[model samples]
Target: MSIPQKLFSEFLGTALLLAIVIGSGIMGERLAGANEAIALVVNTLSTIGGLYILIEVFGPISGAHFNPVVSAVMAYRGLLPRASLPAYVVAQLAGAVVGAWIAHAMFDVSILQLSMKVRSGTGQWFAEVVATAGLLLVILRAPAARVAAMVAAYIGSAYFFTASTSFANPAAAVGRMFTESFAGIAPASVPGFVGAQLVGAALAVAISSVFAGAPVATEIEPKPNV
Candidate 1:
C-alpha cells in the first residue's frame, strides 16, 4: 500500500478504537449508576470487541498499527519502513485526539478538555510497564491469524489486573488525556505512563530478538496489539 493509504488506515483504526474506549466509558459510567466495577466491566468488554474488529478490518491494509510504540518496533525489526515511522506516528496521534473529540461529541460533553483524573505513583507506573511488556510479547509471539484475538484477550485481562487499567499504548495515553471521563488519564500523568510504556516496549523488543535468535526476518508483519 502507498504511504497515504497506510496512514489513513492507521488514522481510522485509531480513531475508532478511541471512540470505542471513551464512548463506552461514558455510557458505562452512566448506566452503571455508581457501580465502578460494573462500569469498568462494560468498558472492558466493549474495548475488547471494538479492538478485535478494528484490527481485523484494517490489518490487511496497514498492519493496523494504532500505537507509536508498535510502529517503532515494527520499523526497528524492518517490517515497516523507517522513513514511514513519522507519518505513522503522526497519524496515530492525530487520530487519537480526533477520536476523543468524537466520543465527547457523541455524548454531548465538552470537547477538547483535559482529564482531571490523576493516575500516578510507583505501582501505577510499574503496572503500565508490565502491561505494555506483556502486550508486546503477545503481539510479537502470536500467530498471524490469531493476533487480533490474543491481543484483545490480553488487554481485557490487563484492564482488571493492572493498576493503571492498562493504557499500554502511548497514543492511547495521549488520547485519553483529552477526556475527563472514567477512562480518561490526566495530561500531567501522561508523561510517566508513556515513559513506562516505552521502557516496556524496549524490553519486549530485546526479549523478542533473543527468542528469535536475531531480529525478525519476516517481510509481512502481524497486526499491532492495540
Candidate 2:
C-alpha cells in the first residue's frame, strides 16, 4: 500500500481515538470528581478499547499505527519505509486536530479544555518512557515469540497503565491539544513528550534488532524447589 494510504489510515484511526478520549475524559472527569484513580481507570479503558478497534479497522490500509511512536519504532526496525515517515506524521497530526475538534463540538465544550495540561514531574516523565518502551517492545518482538495475542493487547495494556496515557503517537500528541479534558496534552508539553517517546521507541528498535538474528533469550527451568 502507498504511504499516503497508510497515512490516511493513521489520520482516521487517531481521530477515532481522540473522539473516545474526549468523550471519556469529560464523562470521567465529571463522574470521578477529583478521584485520580477512577479517572485514570476510565481513561485507560477507553484508550485500550479504542486502539483495539482502530487497529483492526485501519491495519489493512496504513497498518493502523495511529501513533508516531509506533511508526518511529516500526521504521527503525525496517518495518516502515523511510520515505513515508513525514507523510504519516503530517496526516496523523491533521487527523488528531480534526478529531479533537469534533470531540469538542460533540460535547459542546470550550476547545481550550482540549488543551488541558497535566502536572508532570520526574515520575511522569519516567513513566512515559517506561510505558512507551513496553508498547514498542511488544510490537517489535511479537513475531519472534509467536504471541498471536500480543499485537493488540500490548498497546491496549500500555495505555491503561502509562502515566502519559501513552500518547505514543506524536501526531496524536499534537492533535490532543484540541481538548482540554483529562486526555489533553498542552501545546508546550507536546515536544518534550514526543521527544521522550521517540527516544523510547528508538531504544526498542535497537534492542529488537539485536535479538532478531539471535534466538530470543529463554530461561532455564529448575524443578520448582523440588
Candidate 3:
C-alpha cells in the first residue's frame, strides 16, 4: 500500500481502539455505579471485541498497528520499513488523541480534560513490563490466523491480571491521560508507564529470540500493494 494509505489505516485503527477503550470505560462506570470491578469487566469485554474486529478489518492495510511500540518492534525486525517508522508512530499517537476526544464527544462529556487518577509505583510499572512483554510474545508466536483472537484474549486477561490494568501500549497510556474517566491514567503517571512499556517490549524481543525457533509470519506483516 502507499504511504498515505498505510498512515490512514494506522490512524483510523488507533482512533477506533481508543474510542472502544474510553467509551466503554465511561459507559461501564456510569452503569456500574459503585462497582468498579463490573466497570472493568465491561471495559475489558468491549476492548477485546473491538480489538479483534479492528485487526481483522485493517490488518491487510497497515498491519493494523495501532501501537507505537508494535510499529517500532516491527520496524526493528525488518517487517516494516525503518523509514516508515516515524510516520507510523506519529499516526498512531495522533489517532489515540482523536479517539479519546471522539469517545468524550460520544458520551456528551468535555473533550478537553486531564486524568487525575494516579497510576504509578513499582508494582504498577512492573505490571506494565509484564503486560507488554506478554503481549509482544503472543504476537510473535501466535499463528497468523489466530493473531487477532490471541491478542484480544491476552489483552482482556491482562486487564485483570496486571496491577496497572495493562496500559501496555504507549499510545494507550498517552490517550488515557486525556480523559478523567475510569480508563484514564493521570498525566503524571504517563512517563513511568511509557518507560516501563518500552522496557517490557525490549525484554519481549530478547526473550522471543531465545524462546521461539523463528519469527512466525503473522497478519501484522504488511504486504505491498500490487
Question: What total of clashing residue pairs does each candidate reach?
Answer: 0, 10, 1
Query: How far is 112's C-alpha from truth in model 1 (Å)?
Result: 2.3
| lDDT string, candidate 3, 1-226, tens digits | 8999999999999999999999999999999998999999999999999999999999999998899999999999999999999999999999999999999999999999899999989999999999999999988898989999999999999999999998899999999999999999999999999999999999999998896566566534787999
Give the lowest summed-lDDT range of ten residues in model 3: 211-220
- Please list the Cα RMSD from the true structure of every candidate, rounded to 1 decimal place: 5.6, 4.0, 6.0
Write the residue-wise lDDT of candidate 1 on 1-226 in tens digits. Answer: 8889999999999999999999999999999999999999999999999999999999999998899999999999899999999999999999999999999999999997899999999999999999999999988988788899999999999999999999999999999999999999998999999999999999999878778843343545788999
State residue 199's C-alpha deviation in candidate 1, in Å.
0.3
Predicted structure with the largest lDDT when compared to the true one:
3
Task: Give the C-alpha lDDT of model 3.
Answer: 0.94
Q: Give the clash count for model 3.
A: 1
lDDT scores in order: 0.94, 0.71, 0.94
- How are the candidates ranked when ordered by TM-score, highest leading? 3, 1, 2
Which pairs clash in model 2? 6-62, 68-169, 113-179, 113-180, 114-178, 114-179, 114-180, 115-179, 115-180, 116-180
| Model 1 misplaced regions, further than 4 Å | 213-226
Q: Candidate 1 deviates by what RMSD?
A: 5.6
Best by TM-score: 3
Better of 1 and 3 by TM-score: 3
